[model samples]
Target: MQFRSIAMAIGMTALIGATLLAPVTAAEDVPPAPLPSQSLAPLVEKTAPSVVNIFAQKVIRNRSATRYLDGSAFWRLFRDTLLFGYGQDRFESSLGSGVIVAANGVVVTNYHVIEAASGILVALPGGQVYSARVLVSDQRTDLAVLQIEAGGAALPSIAFGDSDRLKAGDRVIAIGNPFGLGQTVTSGIVSATARTSFGVGDFRFFIQTDAAINPGNSGGALIAMDGTLVGINTAIFSTSGGSQGLGFAIPSNMARVMVDGAVKGQTLVRPWIGLSSRTVVPQIAELLGLSSLHGVLVTDVFKGGPADSAGLQPGDVILAIDEFPVDDPQALRYRIATRAAGSTVQLTLERDGEFHKIAVSLQLPPNEPARNESWMPNLSPLRGARVASLSPAFADEIGADSGISGVVVLEVRIGAGAYRLGLREGDIIRDIDGRPVRTVDDLLTFRTTPFKSSRITLERAGSVLTATRN
Candidate 1:
């Protein structure tokens, strides 16, 4: 009986050992926690739904007579008459990408994407498509805000990240419909920040990336690793029409301002400090006694303007804006333009080796030069041509030199005599028949006296052109 008791104790001990070691063996065989999934697939899956493909179409008129070269007078008249019959409207299509910025179906894309488009269509993933309407467009910044009818459906949207905080070498991904090949994703690092002078669009300021931005990539999303949008892919510097690792994007901060302004019914109204300055170079920096070639050397300041009123002198060098380093004049201009009017900005200036912080309120460009649309029925070419008085305000509005003053041709009616004579808009009529035409009244008064022929000396885009009509 004692031996039996000992055997029972051995069996119970063996069973306990087996039960405890079973779990240990199973744990060892379970294979490690999958290395935490280092891929960016999750982030991309979350953000790709917000990136949309845009297709735009417009009717373009083309003439068939232009294709035939025999220009006999008889044939010309016949061809011209036949031109109307042969002239057919061609459907032109453009494709680009856009980012959904709101749950209510607000999208932001490059202005050139939808410019002059009679119809716009936005396609989301899963074969859903919606008609898009352009809410607002800012040509100066080349950005357009679009609204899509969501049919009460909530669409996924991407959050805007701080582009100003982005630095070089930061990893970024771009999602777009490159070449209409459907949705594509590219990866690259931030090549540079504050890129300007690329001649890409109205706004020169850009964020440079090596990301593969191609034709259809315009208006696509450039997202950070966290899936927040940092920029809008706009242009790629390529000679062969392919990505060469040089792509440009509009900064997200600028886009945010545009979107906010658009949704509020006030499309973008860019505020300026009303001054002209040049980037201070190394030589200029040494002469100005600066430490480095960093700052904008104020060349001319508008009298009683924002900078002048803020105690900025002509020789002053702007070092920064609201503590952000101002490496060039364009940078300063962009910073002020992004802010709303009546908002005050702190400018850091250095004069005579001393730095001072000055606050200036942003203001709308003055509209002082009165715009006068005049039509002189008696004058053949001048008829139906719009003229406006040149003032600092008008000059600023039309993007002309504020220092120039005269009567500017604002618009010429299509197919009008003025259009035939090539008296295009932006041509400053300096003289009419040797009579000084400084204002719309001057041109109007001169046109009152009838003459068989007229001589007009005009300045167009800083070039002198004289047209004589007989």
Candidate 2:
């Protein structure tokens, strides 16, 4: 019996060996299925060439140096010899990234990237470099478009994706020159959408991502899995100026507007919805009888404006814009801003426990008075100040009460008497020397015919203060 058991074991071992040595089938020769991965390799390969490193150079004035002789040739020679003239003018350079969005080498980046740059150099992959010119920039949205002569080279361009379709947990990739390092890519998931309260831009609805965005990542491309541009990586919320897993990107929808405007050689004239609103908190939503706490509470609507003309009530809760959910006022602004002027949009709102859809025609923002500003260099209490006639749009843009109309101080130079006396930019001159002042001319008249160091009552950021030059 023992001999028989040993014979069976030997036979079993031989059978296993024969099975292992047998010719593998074509299916067996095929590699095992790849492990599931969040790899962005394929997407990066398709999009990385479109990302470029931007080096901007600017000359800035240095004010800390002592003047040997004010405005004299002798002082200039002495200063140049002693300080190498570095104190008078200092050269500054900024580093950022941009993405080519057109085959003709049209690039898009953050406005701050080339805000004051006198010269811009774009370095593409494979070491090719080219000079870039600013096509257009919109500071309100912090977006800039650049045009580069590619010397007949067909540049790779990135396509814009639907940022409005993004949701939390969606994978994203950020490609840029982090810390001046040439072209690095980082991956993370979208943490939130329509995020507001950043206090950075005028219309602030940003896409929050956990991608490792650092200093030089500004103006870089945030790409979706389909190899499309979802947003422009802009700012990071970091205490150490490094990646803390909190990054913000301007939505591609907004960036698209700037690019379209750049192509048309015109500024993006966004249609205004003419409404001021606040995000609906859970308590507010509950009190309003909303099925879910996911909407914006309209606080005020401009009279004779689009919302008013559409019969929108002040207490209405804006649920969505053409099926896109509106969770905050910023979201509503973003939706309207992205649409063209004269285009009609449907606003889904909840009013008095009933949901209603209203159609509103987008209109150009109110024609505020031109800031054709005049400087007051020789006038007291107004010296070193730039004043403009404040209109509804200007006041609204500056976060002032739209009903308040007066000559608003645009700037007050440091060390000026006005600055010393608590006068500042955005200070609306309610009255000067107890005289009612409503325009820049009124303030100029008051300053020219000054009677006893001007006494001024100004409204600044909702607070009224009396400033006396005497």
Candidate 3:
């Protein structure tokens, strides 16, 4: 019985194989699918010339060595006589990449690459090197513009592409000097867009990709298949300090704003909409009857601001800006900040179960109540700290709550009393010894008064803390 069953199964397999092997007629033969084009050489040839290698050097003076030897006369004499400046000075250097955005040698790179650099050199293709100077450096965006003299020659440059059109699974090529090797190209698809969870910079919006970005790739060009610049490679997520197929780039739209401001010799100021917002969570979405958790829920709107002028109220859900959907507060902020100050944008919002579009004119944050910046006296507990009156403009500049009013610490001198007391920049002085501190004058008055075991209340970021100085 077993032999009979095995024979039947074998006979069935043989019959199916015979039918598959039967010859096909002309009408039944379909054309073979064309092979996918595998080579990216054409795109590389057109875009590689615009990418350049950046070399920056910083000189470090060992002031701590001199300061440490100040109390020891014998050690100072012996060091000056025998050591011969061994610990006095040194040189630090770093390597990175940049993209040429203009034909006349306007280059754009990461601000962190050339930060505090005493000198910078840009090396183009064909072994031509030129001294580059920074036109502007914006730390918030981690972008910088550099200028180099081409001497009447037109250099190859890459034009900016619309990053908003980029979608997940789109092909991208990263051109950079990874590991200080020559210009290297790595290809991958965009893993995600509008990524805001990373703490790379103040502006958290980033384009996440799976490209092989390693050290020395910062400020390089992330190019699309159409040979246009889409993003600037800035950071990577890895535990080994190398590429793990997780890289982040600053979108070209934001980079364009920095380049435009640098070329026009203007300061980089982002447009502000006076609204305190939070991400729309699942609970809030269900409570508000939203179909999907997409958009930011406004909590408060500042008076006399662009949103208020446009009649935007709390509990309104901002869905999009000019038809571009914003998934969270960071995306909304990024969309608004990339536009110019005087331009107008149409915001699509949901209010009372109805979607409405309103035009809001963008503007710089107001600088009402002039910031009379003052430094505290040397003998005071707040000594070596610079205090300024908090206005909308200053508060926005320092990443504080724009609606809050008080005096804020702008800077704290190292090794000073304020620094020792753990007072830092961006700390809003709310009250001093039970007295409400509203302005710099009030802070100065408090600093001048003598009080034993004084307690001070301050607000930092969003948390309130109390500090005491006896």
Which of the numbered candidates is closest to the native, going by highest lDDT?
A: 3
lDDT of 1: 0.83
Pairs of residues clashing in candidate 1: 366-393
- Model 3 TM: 0.81
TM-scores of the candidates in the order shown: 0.75, 0.77, 0.81
Instruction: For model 2, state the Cα shift of residue 295 in Å.
Output: 3.4
Model 1 TM-score (2 dp): 0.75
lDDT (10s digit) by residue, model 2, range 1-470: 99999999999999999999998789867889889985678889999999999999998976544444554777667778976774587789999999999999999999999999999999998699999999987787888999997787889999999999999999999999999978999999999998887877777789999999999999999999999999999999989978999999999999898888788888656677777677888888778777888888886676778888999877899999999988876677788779888899998989998989999998777756565577876745568888887665776566554444578888889988667888788888878767877677776676544355667888865457888776
**lDDT score, candidate 1, position 33:** 72
**C-alpha root-mean-square deviation, candidate 1:** 10.1
Off by over 4 Å in 1: 1-36, 63-85, 282-291, 373-396, 400-470
lDDT for 270 in candidate 2 is 67
Arrange candidates, best TM-score first.
Answer: 3, 2, 1
Better of 2 and 3 by lDDT: 3
How well is each residue in 1-470 modelled by candidate 1, as lDDT tens digits? 99999999999999999998774555677787766666878889999999999999988856453556444465567755866434445799999999999999999999999999999999997689999999997676788999998897999999999999899999999999999999999989999998987887655899999989999999999999888999999999989999999999999999999888888988455776877677888888888788667788886576767777888877788889888888776687678766888899998888998889999988877665467766646454578688887766676556654434568887888878778777887888878778777577777676433567778888775456899877
lDDT of 2 at 414: 96
Look at candidate 3 and tell me the lDDT of residue 414.
97
Please give the CA lDDT of all the candidate structures: 0.83, 0.84, 0.88
RMSD of each: 10.1, 6.4, 6.8
Candidate 3 positional error at 12, Å: 27
